[model samples]
Target: MADNDNRDHNRRDRDDRRRNADGGRPRSGGSGQRGYGADRGGNERRDWGSKERRGEGGDRRSYGDRDSRGGDRQDRRRDDRRSSGDRDNRRGDSRGDSRDNRGGRRPTGARYGQRGDDFTGGPRSGPVRQGFREERMDRRAAEPDLPEGLDLADLDPLVRQDLRVLSKDNAEAVGKHILMAAELVDDAPELALQHARAAKNRAGRVAVAREVNGITAYRAGEWKEALSELRAARRIGGGPGMLALMADCERGLGRPEKAIELSRSEEVAQLDREAAVEFAIVIAGARHDMGQHESAVLTVERMNPDRKDDSFSGLRLAYAYADALAQAGRTEEARDWFAHVVAKDEDEWTDAAERLEALD
Candidate 1:
């Protein structure tokens, strides 16, 4: 009887060890107790082992089994942790797992089989969010209202020729907007910009419309927008008429070096006399902006300030030369040039009178 009891006891010990090695519950009738995966409160704990060893309806997998299933162990662990609400509550989601509930990762478009527009990790709150908001607002902004008595005939004939590519109604509307922009540019630059924007919205592909919009934007001190529209105009029209304005816009934006570089471009040679003179003035202004006053004076000298022409370019050249002379500390010469500009500027286009008074 004692020998038989010893044999039975040794056999039960072997069974307990074998159950522990298999990560299963030990023999309940023996001194060994249940292990981690044992059933508790009628709920069977998940078995992290091979599917072949798991009972029916068991979907959990161990590290080695997960490796054969074609995924890293860490990914499997993350999925297991997420599925167990108790585990997630006990230990917060791991940062290494990007798909956690805290919203730290970009959407995996393939997971949902649909693309998402929100590329940012979380709710965007900085410049990126502001940019999207502004874009939406721009798309929803109300169109500018046309003023009474405005007509397509008021637009310049050259500009009207470019609008022919648009539909008749759209061409007329764009032309009217351009005319309003031109008329209001000197007095109400903001209103002019509205009209210009209206024209661009209606006839964006037309070079003349873009040119007018750029000019109005320049008048309104929108240096960056002015530069962009002017570049678009240049590309579409293949004209150098607005090169001076574009360079001046660079000066307005505090990019004097870019203004100078633009002035030196080969396209400057293609500009008409007035446009060339305007470009030269822009170069001189850029030189002044860089504190190269003496160089600015030299730039203006190349335009022949001694010429007696009383045209618009002549007045602009004289005013710029006088300003350069003033900046260079040639006070007497500057005073003389300013007086000349004041005499020839019959339309009071320049502030030469004020400058001359200040010099005196």
Candidate 2:
């Protein structure tokens, strides 16, 4: 009885080892899990080597199957469709050569699946197409022509070089308008402003074009426009030239306080001799505009106007001093300074001769 009992126990142990709770032998692979397929009872699991079990009726999709198989199938289908269409286009064939050849349908007839416009085999009409073309032509014709006075050949070589940022053809066209603007600035300043605007529209990024626009606007007394363009030019390329003009524009707009503030900025201190003289003149004018005539005279007097130098800046400095004195009610001293200005006014660039005669 004892030997029979031991043999029975050993047989029971072998049975447990060969069969699991689900009634199948352990798999031979890693972790000895079950197969990927499901049984009729919907209790099957995969050999993913993890303890996690799927919920009841959970799908049997695996991560590797979805990524490697599904992704590659999708990519290959897309490539095949593209390559087939490209081959059809290269062959220039309309018949059975098409990727989706629908019984050799002709390419030029009613779009394969859609109805033609009039059943006469023509493109469908939407908005009046000709009307758009006509409107575009009218817009082109209505645009203002570049001024006839524009002549790039007349500009100095250095001046022309400033437009090198633009293409050669664009530079020449914009350069012409700039030259025309300069030519008309004195006699017809408003027209000069128009020319300058044309150049700026063509090459708005060019510093020289912006400078011309600002200067022309200043000449035309368009104070707001001058200030904006000059400020833009200065931001693009820092130079001391625009400071005085910008300050004067401030005075033009009845902002003498702002003008004074700008004149005293650090940039004004670094100005070259010509810009410095112009800055002084504008500052003095701003003081006068604020009804501080004595202060204006004092500002100009600080320049120490010497009668010896006949440079343009020297002449302008002297003239500003004389004007400041006249405006300050010091007529005798004003006349003496004006006389000094007239002696150097050979070209008569300023109205110094007329100013002295008026003082007399």
Candidate 3:
């Protein structure tokens, strides 16, 4: 019984082992866990290659995926490096190029662009445009150091004409500087003489010096000195007013006969109507001063009645004529002449009020 039992158990165990060997199901504990394709040994011997081949086949797919991934990573890294390096280069270039350009600022218009050497399309005068630009910059930079209220003296005639402001070419500007000097001497006679002397020392034939000296001598009560200057002024070819003034000085020195002689000279007769009128008035004043009242009235009557001049020479004669009439006790006629003086003195005849009051 024991032997039979042993035999049955051994047979049953063998059958169970055979069924397990032919079942075609994977092991439960480690299902499908294989190195590459090693499970199909001889039946698919082409698939069951060496560990190196199997590993290569499996590793080829893994290597292909890894290689593709590695290639993408490498490309990304290259792009990052390229973008970073490019960005850095751009930033450095921007910083480096800013210092060279200043007022004439442009991105591409400087050396090799639109302003290609500044000598391409037209002929470039050497250093002219650049020098002018540099000079303007230098002038603007130096503006604070320039003197106040001082204008740059212009020598350019075309620019001066275009602006039409004040022309330095006319030389009136030179007189403007001395205008105050002339006015300062108007009241101070001694200083005026010194100023005239200094001006004469600078250049001969200075009309300004002659005028100032003559006027100062007249003011200082130097009658003979005044006459000397007046004569000198005439000899030096003074203005027409100076001739009138010379006659006046003669009258002032109590030389009525000499004044009459000078006024009625052949030279005086040859002058224009204006000058003749002035001379006639001077003669009338001198005659009146000499107490020749009738002669003074007749002197004005001898003048042509039509002409006029800015000196109002006729007005002076009219006043003197009224005075002479008053002196002669012709009261009614003197009043009429004084009234006429007031009526006709629209040009502001000197001593108009005094002449009118004499008539009243």
Candidate 4:
């Protein structure tokens, strides 16, 4: 009986030691103190064997709450990573939205003089806007070849003064072209026109450049171009000096009625003596073009063509009068006036000498 009791006590001590080694949990398929089939305060412990079989490790309480604390820390770390990723996604989305709001994509092949946003894809800041303007100005028209050693100082002082609005380099280039146009106007009128066009392209706002271009175009027989340039110059400069040329351009364009209209404008009375004489010549020519021979004759007669004056204007007036009389069928009177014009026209400005020969 004593041996059986000792054996039972030793067996209980072995089971307790095994439970302590297994973290004080009951062994599987055994009933011992605090066994799996036992209840603690009417609540059974969780089945750790089933949990381990299902890959859930074991009860967190069995290992002194290590798994519970570790799981909570890991869960917090995972939540932090998820939140950080969400913030990054939001930032990326906002950047895309900003790009769309700015103006999406830039237009391809946008030309010069177009709006600034067409090329930039958005509203330009100050430096960018100024750069775009410079690019527009740099896209200049075709320019003529400038002669070597040509002096910008040779340009008229008044014209140079007008070019002060331009940059120094641009003014110098424009002045050189204007001087070349003036030099070649009467001799190589077509080449003069190219130079004047170059000057006008560089200094379009300058009235003298437009005026020179108009005169060069007139000499080149580009009547319509001459009319347009003269009109632009008149609008910018506000003067009557080019009124006669404008009237002549009207005549050249087959608008003799328009020429007559220009002759009667208030600007006519403001013309200088030379311009007035030239205006009279153009008006008489307009009358002749309209087949009003007597009216044409009277137009030049009002200018008082005199042999004693002998000036350039006087010579041109007398020649016009003689031609008008010839057109009016007053043969003897025309012959007499033509003879007088030939005597005074030493500069040979008129075809009066030829008219006299034709009459004879």
Q: Model 1, 210-322: lDDT tens per residue?
A: 88889999999999999999998776666465988999999989899999998778888788878878888889989988999999999989889764887888888889899
Residue-level error in angstroms, candidate 3, position 11: 99
Question: Which one is best on TM-score?
Answer: 4
Residue ranges of candidate 4 with Cα displaced over 4 Å:
1-141
Clashing residue pairs in candidate 2, if any? Answer: none
Task: List TM-score per model, in order.
Answer: 0.59, 0.58, 0.43, 0.62
> 14-73 in candidate 3: lDDT tens per residue?
987865553423332233222222354512112111223313223212111112211233
Ranking by lDDT: 4, 1, 2, 3
Instruction: List per-prediction Cα lDDT, in the order shown.
Output: 0.74, 0.72, 0.51, 0.74
lDDT tens readout by residue for model 4, 47-158: 2222332243443232112222122333354566556556666666554532334333223334313544323232332245557666546645456778799987777777
What stretches of model 3 exceed 4 Å from their correct place?
1-190, 238-241, 305-314, 346-349
Weakest 10 consecutive residues, lDDT, candidate 2? 47-56
- Model 1 segments more than 4 A misplaced: 1-141
Candidate 1, which ten residues in sequence have the lowest lDDT sum? 117-126
Per-candidate clash tally: 0, 0, 0, 0
- Model 3 poorest 10 in a row by lDDT: 61-70
